[model samples]
Target: MAENKSTSARAASAASSKTEADIQAQIDQLRGDIANLTKLIGDLGSEKASQARARAEKLRDDATKAGQEAYDRARDEALSMEEDLEDRIRMKPLQSILIAAGVGFLAALFTRR
Candidate 1:
């Protein structure tokens, strides 16, 4: 009977040690997994930041190009209007001078207030 009790106790102790070792190994594995998760999150953040920067740069470039095109179009239209005005003035110098004088008189009248 004493031998039986001793053997049972030995068996229980062996099982307990195995359980503790298993728990320790699981804790180590969890730590490693946490570290890997943290690294993955950081890498993802970096990748997203890079993508955002690239997108912003592309948007900025697109806006700049659109602005330049609009400016060019406006300048071309202004030049066309200037040439038309000049041609009209050359065709009717007296009329052009009379229109300019009338516009200046109206402007002076409005500005007097």
Candidate 2:
């Protein structure tokens, strides 16, 4: 009877030790998994942030290009109109002088305080 009890006690101790070891192994695995997941999340966040920056830079460049194009068009139109005005004035010098004087007089009158 005493030997039976001793054998049962030994069996229980062995099972307890195995359970503790298994639980420790599971805890270690969980810690490793948590660390890996944390790293993955950080990497994903950095990649997304980099993508956003690239998109923003592209948008800024596009806007700058569009603004430059508009400026060029406006400059071209202004130069063409100036040439046309010069030709008209050259063809009718006296009329152009009179019209300019009249516009200046009217502007002076309008700006009077």
Candidate 3:
């Protein structure tokens, strides 16, 4: 009877040790998985930030190009108007001077009030 009890005790101890080792291995594996997941999330965030910056730069460049085009069109229209006025004045200098004097007199009259 004593021999049988000793064999059973040894068997129980070995089983307990194996169970503890398995539990420890599983815990280590879970820690490694969590670390890998954290790193993946960080990488994804960086990629998104880079994409956003590129989009913003493209929008800025497009806006600048549009503004320059508008300015050039306005400048051309103003030059055309200036040339037309100069040609009309040269065609009739005396009439242009009389019109200018009338406009100045009206302006002075309004300012006096």
Candidate 4:
């Protein structure tokens, strides 16, 4: 009976140690999983920020291209109008002078108020 009691005590101690080891392993695994999940979430956020930055850069490029195109078209139209005005002025200098004076007078009149 004494031998049996010693054997039983050893068995219980072994079982307790194993249980403690298993619980520690579970805690360590949970910590590792949490670390991995945190890293994955951070990586996902960085990827999204990169994608958004790329989109914003593309939009800026598009806007710059559109602005240049509009500027070019407006410049061409202005040049054409200037050529036409020059031709008309050469054909009738006196009439052009009279028109200019009339415009100046009107501008002065509006400014006086």
Candidate 5:
């Protein structure tokens, strides 16, 4: 009976040691997997940031080009209006001068009071 008790104790100790070793190996494998996943996440974040910066730069360039086009269109319209006014003044110089003189006379009369 004493010999049987001793054999059972030895078996239990061996089994406990084997289980402990297996658990340690699993913990080490999980740590390695965690490290790899962290690195992959960081790389993806950097790639996404680079893509966002490129998109922002493209948008800024597009806005600048649109603003320049709008400025050119407005300048062309203003030039057309100026040329049209000049043509009308050349065709009726006396009328333009008379209107200017009338406005000036009215301004002067109002200020004299």
Candidate 6:
């Protein structure tokens, strides 16, 4: 009976020690995983920041291009309107001059005779 109890105690001690070692190994593995995860998160954050900066630069460039295009279109439209007005004035110069002369002559006649 004494020998049997001694053997049983030894077996229990061995099992408990193995369990403790397994728990320790798992803890170590978890620590390593945590470190790797932290590094990956940091890398992702840096990549995200760089991407954001690139996007901002692209947006700024796009806005500048759009503004320039709008300015050019407006300038062209203004020049076209000026040209159209000039052409109309040139086409009717004789009629405009005659009308002005008639108005002036009537005013003079009314004032003098």
For each candidate, give its TM-score against the true structure.
0.82, 0.93, 0.86, 0.88, 0.73, 0.57
**Which window of 10 residues has the lowest lDDT sum in candidate 4?**
76-85
Candidate 3 segments exceeding 4 Å error: none
RMSD of 3: 1.7
lDDT tens per residue, model 6, 1-113: 99999999999999999999999999999999999999999999999999999999999999999999999999999999999977977999988788889999999999996
Q: In order, how many clashes per candidate? A: 0, 0, 0, 0, 0, 0
lDDT of model 5 at residue 10?
97
**Ranking of all candidate structures by their TM-score, best first:** 2, 4, 3, 1, 5, 6
Collision count of model 1: 0
**Candidate 2 lDDT, tens digit per residue, 6-89?**
999999999999999999999999999999999999999999999999999999999999999999999999999999999999
Query: Candidate 5's residue-wise lDDT over 51-86, tens digit each?
Result: 999999999999999999999999999999999989
- Superior by TM-score: candidate 4 or candidate 5: 4
Task: Look at candidate 3 and give me any clashing residue pairs.
Answer: none
Cα lDDT of all candidates, in order? 1.00, 0.99, 0.99, 1.00, 0.99, 0.97
- What's the CA RMSD for each of the models? 1.9, 1.1, 1.7, 1.6, 3.0, 8.2
The Cα error of candidate 4 at residue 110, in Å, is: 3.4
Give candidate 2 misplaced runs (Cα > 4 Å): none
Report the C-alpha lDDT of model 4 over 1-113, residue by residue, as the tens digit: 99999999999999999999999999999999999999999999999999999999999999999999999999999999999999999999999999999999999999999
Report the poorest 10 consecutive residues by lDDT, candidate 2.
104-113
Candidate 3 structure quality by residue, lDDT tens digits, 1-113? 99999999999999999999999999999999999999999999999999999999999999999999999999999999999999999999999999999999999999999
Q: Itemize residue pairs with steric clashes in candidate 6.
A: none
